[model samples]
Target: MKTQKNFRPFVAAIAAALLGGALAGCAPLLVGGAAVGTALMVTDRRTSGAQIDDEAIELRSASRLREAFGDRAHINVNSYNRQVLLTGEVPSEAAKQQAEQIVGRVDNVRGIVNELAVMAPTTLPQRSGDTLITGKVRASFVDASDLQANAFRVVTERGSVYLMGRVSQREADRATSIARQIAGVQRVVRIFEVVDATDLRQLAPVSTGTPATVAPAPAPAPAAAPAGGAVVTPVR
Candidate 1:
């Protein structure tokens, strides 16, 4: 049960992000004079295999959620390296917990970070503002010389920015510092998988344009993320 430190009362997301249950799917990666769009298979840290497993996990979880709750919830599922992070809204605490449980049962899901808020879903304007905030944070990441824009995945709910990725402690701290300073951001929630050089080999290989027509993947192996688990940075 996590909470936004100083988040405002309202928030929202882009309609396109609604697909695959990944709220705000991938934010517009606005880098130096270029917008590389959202899906960055080539540069992503997750192995091409893990990335696909994440997508399946999200879709399966979303489908089950829809069957179980329907319009009763507005939940977003984001999985990185087989770890699923739940965000957005649910009608009650019970619904929230239930949502997490349902996703936990999905195939290939190795971990769950439950960040679902217990309340009503966000309105259109709030979602729009969230989209705007995500863009700002993304641009800030790109503008910072020390940061690689795609290394962090940004998801904004209301005015709270949820950053998900595999990064080092310094990168995490630097990204957190930048996110908390944004104009519309009232809180920064970091869901980073902190790792060092030795941890590199444990990750999935870089994406190599594997076709969707490729054969179904085997079950996801145990996560190689460090033993401390997801670094839950204090919401600032």
Candidate 2:
């Protein structure tokens, strides 16, 4: 009976280890599914058409990028409301420039932020670490009560977190603060198209016979395109 009991504990330990390994392997897929489902439920600031356009931009840009650079570059194309943020590494500066040009030709791309470095591609382990950092930053946003976590898109490359969203100044500041607090985030770069509180309020559906409010002042002009085809527009 004692021998059987010892064997049972060993079996239990093996079972626990197998279960842990299974959960670890499935974590990314499960998280991705949850993210997509949550995104569908949220009231995003972008119009439905804009959302579709952003998806299309990512697909088309990626296709073109593959055709141009193939294995020479490791590029990530992320589009939030038609603004594309390109990260990863290329073999040369020429490949980097070509990436931007290819993405620029995609339909409905309002702007591009090419943060691609000219170096050897990052290994899988580095990419895995970036994914974990991104998850931490995203969880921080979800924990903050005042912020609409769904409004921001988090992308991490080599520890730099690129935040893309259509958000107000206050929300942008709050997100930046949260991202900076995360342990692995080396930098937080804002790629937000900043709107005012009034704009955000207007996003809500109006009821019938609601009194009209005064029109808000026009938004400031977007910042000029930065050199090398990366558009980093500051909120004025």
Candidate 3:
């Protein structure tokens, strides 16, 4: 019986050692994978559509809370899997309730977790700056015909602008380009919604610059010229 008990202890030690070694080997792979994922998330102008949607929900929630509570509320919105978690501070019970109401209004919002502390109201200057940043980015979308601004949610932290939107590859590129061109943009993080090429092709390119005279869209029929008249097919 003693020998058998001793054998069990030896077996347990071997098992533990194997498990430790296995975990050690997996550590580097796990780290590498995480690094790659993070890099892709940060660098790729085109990001997964689902992630963009989540970010949109979060941003809209925070923005609505900001509007309803005005300078009274300081809110942070975080989303995961369509669920929004609202955390921050407000000055009163009414303000906290108002924040909840605002979050509820955002579309695609699954659930909310309000963790707001009642405190002093936010300053006028801070609120004004937030409004300015939001208005500028929002107006840019409204003016740009080719871009879908509504698909995105804009969030401003300090001087930085965070854009969240679902988009085609082309739309992602255009959006990033526009954000970069904006004068005060500190950093643009693309929480883009990517779609297939077929869907992307359907999006029309906006005409803003000099007008070009070109042939009309082709009709799906054979064209014939009158007798002695030549039919001209433009050369590429």
Best-to-worst ranking by lDDT: 1, 2, 3
Error of 2 at 81 (Å): 1.4
Check candidate 1 and list the clashing pairs: 11-126, 11-158, 12-126, 12-127, 13-127, 47-204
lDDT of each structure?
A: 0.63, 0.63, 0.47
Count of steric clashes across candidates, in order = 6, 0, 2
Per-residue lDDT of model 1, residues 59-120, tens digit only: 78778888898877787777766767777888899988898889889988777777778888
- Candidate 3 lDDT score at position 82: 48
Off by over 4 Å in 3: 1-73, 78-122, 197-236
List model 2 lDDT by residue over 121-199, tens digit each: 8888987777667766666676689998767777778887777766777787678777777777776667766676897
TM values, all candidates: 0.72, 0.71, 0.38
Error of 1 at 88 (Å): 1.3
Minimum summed lDDT over a 10-residue window in model 1 is located at 26-35
Distance from true location, Cα of 48 in model 3, Å: 19
Flag regions of model 2 displaced more than 4 Å: 1-42, 204-236
